[model samples]
Target: MSPSVLLRWALRDSARGVTASWIGGLGYQAGLILLPWCLGRALDEGITPGDRSPLLSWAAATLAVSVALTGAEFAMRWWATLAGVRTGNRLLLRLSERVLGWDAVTAHRFSAGDLVTRGTRDVEQITIWISTVPSLASGVLGLFTVLVVVATLDPMLAVVGLGTVPLLIAVNLWYPRRYEAANAALSAAHGARADAVEDLLSASTAVRGLGGEQVLVERHHEASATVHDRTLALARIAAGWAANAPFVPWLATAAGLAFGGLAVLDGRFSVGGLVSFASWMTLLGRQVMMLTFRFGQLGDAWTAAGRIEAVLSAESEMSDKATSLLPAGALATDGVSVELPDREPLRLPDLSVGPGEFVAVVGPVGTGKTTLLRLLARLADPSTGAIRYGGTDLRDAAIADVRDTITIVGQRPLLLSGTIAENLRLGRTELTDGQLREACRIAGILEHIESLPEGFATEVGERGSTVSGGQLQRLALARGLLRGARVLLLDDVTSAVDARTEQRILDGLRELDVTIVFATSRTAVRDRADRVVDLGVHDGELVSHG
Candidate 1:
């Protein structure tokens, strides 16, 4: 989807609100024209003739119009705000849904910072544009009305007022291309700065331990300087435009005043008519200036929309076709090979494990044990071959169904910043408290959890920082278990737990009647497995021993 299409869709979605805002704006503009007309009427029929009754009547009418204008302005603002918020929320939800549908590998191409900027800051810019639409529309309507009113007072003055339109258009056309280019550069700088900050924060501990703090700080400083330079450049362009925008309007006002004065002196115009024409010209000038400013803002908004549109239109790693759910049978990999970026292919020998079997995958470092588990979990598709559940190829199975039947616990588990129960029931929101406790007990972390001040309700600080390493692993295990998946893939889950805890966890697993495939180097864990597949062989043979 292009930005133009996205913006059109948003407008359609909030059509009713947007229409109401435009109506209110037009009404307010009409009221503004009435105000100047009333002043001219008071001057012509009552003040100059010294008639108290007509003057009082005109004064009352002006007051009434002022009140009506206030109400119209209020309505315009209220509906515009509603339209902006509604459209913004819709865009945000759509972006989130698109992100969620993306496979792990595809999603990894975007950094957390970049995604955040697109979803938040970019969305805000579009919303700001939506809100300004009513104002711009009203300004145009008001400008035309002022010109028409001036023409009625004096045709010569109207011609002078109309001259400003082309100049305003020229100013807008000249500045936006330059302003937009600057805004795009500024936006890139901001995103780069955000990425640097996010990278530093995510690896703060590693940087500190490796004595690379200064290095990272310098990198961040460079990113910040780039952002500052871009921002300064953008500000300079805006400043120049701002200083030049007023000149067109000023020139129009001066010409209208001089023309109207000559007409009045030549007995072709009344004093009241001259005042009314000048008032209309002044209002027209203000509207043109406002339009020019909004045009600049629209340029920035367009750039932001384009960025968001790029993400929304990106292709997902997985196909969108609906497929059958995985059936109960052996899990097998045939001629499976995975080639990571800039790395040699890790090929796995053809192997199959019967349903409900416990298999241990053993391999030295860089032998692709974790990669095998990731492939099984559908994190990434094999580059060369197919993985099958039962007789059906994994690629033909629905991705959501595959995920529901198979869950993986990574070596370094990530816990969200929430209560223990909340983390455990991340995806399985329907799980009861009792089910949560049972899963935790089976993972061998229930005792530690119960000892906490709030037990299941205790808040686990960001990334589970409040818990010990062992506890974090167990919590993740519990979360996967609570999903009730038929196939559980554990990638060195017991690496952090002590031997006794690992034994207990393995013992509890034996009673689940589910297929278990885990990668580990622990002898005890291998000893407990029904079969072990070694990946340490030079020829990449299965080397299964029972």
Candidate 2:
């Protein structure tokens, strides 16, 4: 999507709030114009003639207008803030939805830190533009209001006010493109720095083992230096423009003062009219300054909008037309092949497994064992064949239905910072406590959990740091079992456990009435399976044995 389309989408999402904010801004600008006019009326009709009663009446009118202006300004601010927050939230939701639906290959294109920055810092940049819209609108309306009032006071003074408009327009047009380019560069640098820092922290152990801490530090320093330099360049441009902005309005004010004063002396203008004209010119100056600042914000927002659009516009791997329900039976792959970028294609022989059979896939490292499992799980699509379950192509079935029917446990178990029960019920929240414990028993983790101080209520630290590696794997197994999927795919899930523990876990798994496909290199694991598929000697082929 283009930046314009992205901006339009954001506006559409927050249309109601934006419309209300515009209304409030219009009212605020009207009040601003009226305040100076009321003061001028009091000076001309009452104060000048020394009429105490009329002067008192006009004074009270001016005070009332000031209070009204304050109220209008408050309303404008409130509405603008509401619009900004709502738009930011909507964008965040849309980005998250898109990211969640992406296939593994598509997701690998973005770093975790980059995605976070786009969802947070980039959204905030866009919100800045949305919030500033009302102010920009009010300034524009006020500029016109001032011009009309000044023209009424004296046509010559109106010409002086009008002179600033073209200059301001020229400055706005020239600055935004340059400023936006600089801002985009700075944003890129910042995202890079964030990614480097996140990587360093996440892999601190490996960095220390390899003694590459200095290398990572130097990389982060380079990214930070780029950001600092870009920021300085952007600041210089802003400073230059700001220094010139005040001069436009002040020059107009000087012209109005000199000419309007002479006009008053020539009996063509009143003293009150001259004072009102000067005040209007000053107000116009302030409007120009506000618009200049908003224009800069607008430039930054455009850059951010483009970045966000790139993510939103990416093609999703899942098919929207896949609405058929997946049936239960045998699983098969026909002429399956996967071709990754710059890597040789992995082609598998035609294979089939009966429903409820336990099958083990054994292959050497880099033999595409995990890739085959991912294909079967629909985490990726095969480049050249179809994966079928129960005689129906998975491509024809709804992705959500297919995923609901299959559970995959990766080599590395992932657990959130929550109680053991909480993690077990993540996939199926309606599971009773008895069911949770039953699943834990089936995964051979019940005794371990019961031995803990809090039993099932024990808190797993972030990423399951509180648990041992083997325990973490067992917890992941229990969570998957709770889902009760028809098919279970495990990728070296028992690698961390001892042989006896691994045998016990396998024995428990064999009792379940479900199809199991596990990849392993251990002879004990392969021997336990009802059938085994060997990928170690056939190049890309699969040789099966019972």
For each candidate, C-alpha RMSD in Å? Answer: 2.1, 2.6
> Where in model 2 is the C-alpha error above 4 Å?
48-51, 265-267, 317-320, 341-343, 417-422, 427-429, 450-459, 539-546
State which candidate has the highest TM-score. 1
Question: Which stretches of candidate 1 lie above 4 Å from their native place?
Answer: 48-50, 538-546
Tens-place lDDT per residue, model 1, 370-393, is 989988988788989998888778
Displacement of the residue 494 alpha carbon in candidate 2, Å: 1.0
lDDT of 2 by residue, 1-546 (tens): 678888888778777777788888887888778877877788788684645998898889988888888888888888888999989988999999999888987898888878888888899988878888887877787888787777777778878888787987787777777888888888787788889887777666577968788888887888789878998999998887776786788898999999999998999988877877777788887777887888888888888999899899887776654665445688888999988779888887566877888888988898878988888889988999898998778888888778888889888988998889888888566799999888888778888889999999999988898898889988998888887789999988898888988888999998999999998887878888888887776743444556
Tell me the TM-score of each prediction against the true structure: 0.94, 0.92
